[model samples]
Target: MNRSAAEKEYEVNYYEIDYNEKLLITGLVNYFGDIATRHFENVGGSLTYSKEKGMAWVLYKWNIDINRYPKYGQKIKVRTNAYSFRKFYGYRTFEAFDEKDNIIARANSIWLLIDTNKRRILRIGEDMYKIFGLTKKDNKPLFIKKVKLPEKFSIEKSFNVRYSDIDTNRHVNNVKYIDWILETIPLDIILKYTIKHINITYEKEALYGEKIKIFTELKKQDEEGYISLHKIVDEKGKELSVIEAIWGIEEK
Candidate 1:
């Protein structure tokens, strides 16, 4: 694949920014989603397969690194391309850049072709693989570190799903889950810090009207007062997801 290919540009909209006037993390995910969907449409692939078959492309995992966040009025270009494929999964990469072409963020994700009706992973059909033109590569993805739950982590808040939390798939969207977890922290803490890393695992789907309990624990705080630890639990008290968020004071 040519890394120098012209990047696909997208205009920033009012709805895409958060109260802080920067693109929300969820908004960034949606942009990537849009790019992937358009790529499929160009190749004559179906984007609504999940709705038709009761199966959808559920995000199994993702690792995102951002050098800086885009401001509200900035016009950014997001370039995405599929690099490789494995049995039931396809690997893809994306880059978000400013109009001047400075890279702002990059991500690598693992997507599972799922059978929504049966709630199981579906094998990648040969026809689907051919459509995307993906090949096997010798390089491996960055191995995300997993942490074991401490003996005594506790729930901070419990929330019930509102209509707004559900996406077209009738399940909680990946970014919404992140928002929910972040909301558990104090606003003062959120404003004073910058996220250095986040590692999340999607365990199961939480449907509308399900009551979810969010559990969090402070595993450690460094000399600079940066916070890090495990976050988990959903409405049913089941382990819906696990995340490790590292934070540091924003430099002056």
Candidate 2:
């Protein structure tokens, strides 16, 4: 591995692996997030910087495609680069590779800068673009389109946001949204299947002690696997996010 400034290495530890002994989707999300945070810190735009500026970076959407699952104790490298930005949105790409240089996963995400005090979107300035060290060579993010859910949900559950879910931004971290969605899934389904693609759109922010409600429904199925739609909301019916995932059953 080149170990360039844009790349960071992480080992798949016991805690990050699931019952199947493979790195889980939530674990991969957390790794990409940590790498992105490192990039911010390297460019003097860390969480502290956002706080001092009375603003914070919020994840708006994400799409991940997994080719192979890295098993426990495998060392993986995460490569991330910020390519473009608009008024309030920034686009970044992430890739995970195994020790043999096999690409295990790829992801695209969109983020927004919001005023923490007023909770409004901030018009990203030219200087802010430079702060991310953008190359301006990347294409527009492909997964920005809205994710539509099924008309009726088959499963709905509620959970209390715990202290651990809060990140440095003082809000329910975006990664937890994936965790909650996975939790709502049945264990039998998880053990029998694997997810190859996931698309999530974050519409609202959840805070500590907030109650989150998750709703899921089977969208469709094929020989390979199935796709499920999920909606995350607060107790008051405010929609927090929507996620659509494509899963395939393990080969016999």
Candidate 3:
């Protein structure tokens, strides 16, 4: 029970930036995921170890807030901490800091440990707890604000999942949903605004070659900016994931 967090430094690269020179959402999430993996590996939780035990971690929910997107070539430090553990869930937090040490973004995520063989959630074991250096159990409820689907979607798009979309988990990677969510937004909105906040809840997995649909609704613009709600479903209309995003004009 010594170390529980890990940190890394990154410089934004051209490939990770969008047309406006701001880091893409996917790129930021990649950094967050990488640090989480590194932290676990540092604490004796390696992929080989998990595979040997037929165990893997899967994301359940995420809530991220950004003060501003990091620009291309900007150097920033990202850190992830394993703060708490419940029976079947792990609670982790992430923060990205600019060169000035200002926290540019913060995120909290929930993950579930799954038995790869049975493909069901597994309760946290004492050994796993020891690996993360966590001893105290968190009794307080961990919550993710519900993302309600709009009654009527203003826009809809469909895509067939591709092999490249699959991660080691054999399903669409969690970050791929962000691309699908953004695809439903209009070009004007994407060009005019930046994602300020995003909340996503995963309900089901999308497999390769499955036809999935995304429905989006743009709510009325308020002082903060625009809010968009999205729902992802399989061809049969089975809900897979729900997302809520807030977009705002970037402050110079």
The lDDT per prediction is 0.70, 0.83, 0.90
Comparing candidate 1 with candidate 3, which one achieves the higher lDDT? 3
Clashing residue pairs in candidate 1 (N, C-alpha, C atoms within 3 angstroms): 50-55, 55-116, 211-235, 212-234, 212-235, 213-234
Question: What is candidate 1's lDDT per residue for 133-236, written digit by digit as tens?
Answer: 64444224545456555666654777888888887667887888778877787676677665655667777788899888777776447545444455556654
Residue-level error in angstroms, candidate 1, position 114: 0.7
> Which segments of model 2 are wrong by more than 4 Å?
1-5, 135-141, 250-252
- Writing each residue's lDDT as its tens digit, candidate 2 over 1-252 gives 211237889999999898878988889999999998888777767787878889877889998989878889989999987867766788888999989998889998899988889988997776566676553453355556678877899898899999999987778999888889888788877888888999999888899999989999875576677788899999899999999899986433
Instruction: Show the lowest summed lDDT stretch of 10 residues, model 2.
Output: 134-143
Question: What C-alpha lDDT, on a 0 to 100 scale, does residue 249 get in candidate 3?
Answer: 90
Best by TM-score: 3
Candidate 3, residue 124: Cα displacement in angstroms equals 0.7
Query: Candidate 1 vs candidate 2: which has greater TM-score?
Result: 2
Clashing pairs for predicted structure model 3, backbone only: none
